[model samples]
Target: MVISSQKENDVLIKPDKVIKYKNSNIILNISNLSIGYDKKVIAENISFNLKKGELVAIVGVNGIGKSTLLRTIGGFQTKISGSIQIEGKELTTIDTLDLATKVSVVLTEPIASKNMSVKELLALGRQPYTNWLGKLSDEDIAFITKSVSLLELTPFLDKKCYELSDGQLQRVMIARALVQDTSIILLDEPTTHLDLYHKVQILKLLKSIAHKTEKTILFTSHEIELAIQLCDKMLILDGRTNPFEEPCKLIEHKNFETLFPADMISFDANSGSFKIKK
Candidate 1:
């Protein structure tokens, strides 16, 4: 319940001088977005911006429209109102193939092609760039190789997806997204079935990817504490007051304290943790 900014110095692939590069380009913009189905609005008046090299998390209690908002941004669902733009272009106006090139989405659903090899699954990410015969060009091969190297999937390239562990499979899925070569990546509950260790591992990998590759990574997670520690910014979907800000700023504003009922739990801002109240 308590959210605080904790810097991670142990990220892999640290650049020289550790310069905090200011990314001026907005990768994803949501303006007064109201997401829902049909005519009903689950959440309204939500606005946020994500920049390159930023990792942002969307968090809220169950049924607070986190997934709905993500789906809307990923172009999987229609927004009830407002606008979504990717790199200064309207998301709705982008063609499906073009959209695939600009944004990649990873959902909680299990991979249907379990028999597909790791390399084959990762290669599927290049479908947007492939010809009618689905042949991979040299550039496509390079992208696939880069993604595999980034995620350290070199050893398992020939292994079937069904044989990988949850964490390994998750990394493979992320690599697949990277092979798509998009500026923005959206994940819905990427830590859904992961254990605590695997959850931290996946989140750290994501943060590292965002910082190292300058990609805009946004995801919905119930692991608020982990997200606060690892993400650069956060979008808190409180249903009553949706706020997007840095974790420390949100903590200074006492946003996390109000995230849940106060009777059963209490937030310790100093330690950035929650405790049960007796």
Candidate 2:
């Protein structure tokens, strides 16, 4: 999924040019993307480009189409209008098998059976490269082993997922995605059901993964303040503008001030965190 150069048609509609970050290539591109169902548009006119080695968070008020946007971009749902491209190729044009190799998605949905061991769960991520019988190849095992070490899952390898705490299970899920080894990883609320410290820990881990592996990681989260602290970039689904920019730039432009009702909570640009007016 390495894109050394962009084709003529690959230019972004908004910028009308390629987006380069820290000399990294743009891995995912969304232009004027509209996501919804039954002809009802939940979010529209959304556009952003994600570069390799970037950790991006999508934050918004409830029902602002955060998960829908993620689902649509992951190709799990239909897009009413607009384009989602990976490596300069339109998403819809890519075949299922090829797309599997390009993007890996991690939803907050519970696993079918929590009785499965951590090793068993991580093995599932290699399905894209497995043979018809689903036997593990030496190379697949090597990749899995490396991911386990990177994510520090060795101790929990034999433990059933149900035996793990919420934070541990979340780490296992992320390790599975790492095993997938896709160019882009999409997660819905990776830090859900965690305490404040764990939330910050997980987000920091994600940031580290993105920088170290150079994979584009995008996830929908409600941790706006944590995102502002740890994420390389953020996209706010504000229903109208849906602004996307770096945390500092977004704070400087006052984009976070109006995300919620002004009467109850307000964004404190100085601390880059939200505050209660009371």
Candidate 3:
């Protein structure tokens, strides 16, 4: 069943202006963005302003440029064209270390170091703040303590990173990002390899970070329904074009089914879910 509202209001208009929280900031802005790999354009025309205190999910089916878009904004891939501004400054203008200080990324990739304990892994986040030869002061300890608490990882500090469950490992990774203390945080497929409970937990934690810390967040996830329910907004891609919008409006436009397996499944408006046909 195709999902929709009974109201006859036209489903399309200029998207609403982004809302702001008191004393919050706009941490990421991309205009006419076309991001590519090896000169092939994987995503383009992505324009949006991400306000602080907003959790944004990048939603699209596999191979629809979700990661490409993220890499471009994260400065992992160069934008073939367009402007990306982080904290009202041009993205390319920032030096590498400075850029790293501004944006922290939490990817779904497996942690590379086998020897590191959870505490040691989290210590890497302090790299930007540490002096040469890597020393941690009391302030660093305080920040790491806060991150561990936020992710509820205090008890696992001495545990080896490889020993944790997938969910716990994911939380540890996020704690590492939090210690980085960047204005913007981006994650790609953060829920991959996680169980349903862990998925919800991670999303809730990210949402809390956005609101309580007033940080701008953009994450790419395959959990379409979860994204709709939890995020303040989402960027739905068409071909290479990502149209940034709120979930309710996208539902109102009946654009939900287009994001996934075309004919076999449909969106359920009353239930606010996507379901397969019998």
Candidate 4:
């Protein structure tokens, strides 16, 4: 991956802060990228490179553009400027059909219908590779079966999506992404609305999937403490230099200390968690 050190007046370039990695497995590379609506920039100067088998989290306070950054990277929304390259190809140049095989996205929005069986919902992940008639090949079925087993969804395969609880449905959604078999999986708030135990369970599952399957998994999350424990790397969208590095390095640099109001909560680097001030 190329790391540009050139400085621009309008850009918040941090060549010194950015970590450099020499690996052929790098699939997703974002350099000085900006994301937002027309004429309104939500975040800028974002730079990071993700390699296969890495589970990364994008965390920040609410409205810090974590979700927007995920959408922009997944190609659901437009980027204002800079680069988003998948395997050396620009994101904008790739067409929808071809892009589907490279990146899979899971958003926080509700499904169109929960009446579909869990197995049926997972079958949709292979739609990109299916023929015009939308028939699943043996390979596709095998992929679905493998993902089901990995996510522990076998017991719920015949059950309707509506019958599953929040945690189960979330696992199903992640399983669907795994079934897609894309090189990169982008999830927006994958652990939202879950209790602490379930939240940890889901994050641990994601970390396992990424490592065992060699898929690059990136998710936006509010569970900063859990993310620090489970993620291999993290990108804090502070809207400035947007520091991206390993979890230990981020904590060593005290990035989480300034994430919120100092009067309310403070980061305890010793324990790698945020504690409310008394």
**Candidate of highest TM-score:** 2
RMSD of each: 9.0, 3.4, 8.0, 5.4
On the 0 to 100 scale, the lDDT of residue 142 in model 1 is 98
* TM-score, cand. 1: 0.90
Q: What does candidate 2's lDDT look like per residue over 75-162, in tens digits?
A: 8998998889887777888899999999998898999999999999999999999999889999999989988998788999999999
Ranking by TM-score: 2, 4, 1, 3
Report clash pairs, candidate 1.
none
TM-scores vs. true structure, each candidate: 0.90, 0.92, 0.89, 0.92
User: Clashes per prediction?
Assistant: 0, 0, 0, 0
Query: Can you give the lDDT of residue 165 in candidate 3?
Result: 87
lDDT at 40 for candidate 4?
97
Alpha-carbon lDDT, every model? 0.87, 0.90, 0.82, 0.90
The digit string of per-residue lDDT tens for model 3 on 60-90 reads 8788788888887888878888778787667
Return the lDDT, model 2, position 156: 99
In the range 35-135, model 1's lDDT, one tens digit per residue, is 99999999998998788889999999999999999999889999887778787666878899999999998988898879999989998999999999889
Q: Can you give the lDDT of residue 246 in candidate 3?
A: 87
TM-score of 3: 0.89
Clashing pairs in 3: none
lDDT accuracy of residue 187 in candidate 2: 94
Those runs of model 3 whose alpha carbons end farther than 4 Å from true positions after fitting are 1-24
Look at candidate 4 and tell me the lDDT of residue 214. Answer: 95
Q: Show model 1 residue runs off by greater than 4 Å.
A: 1-24
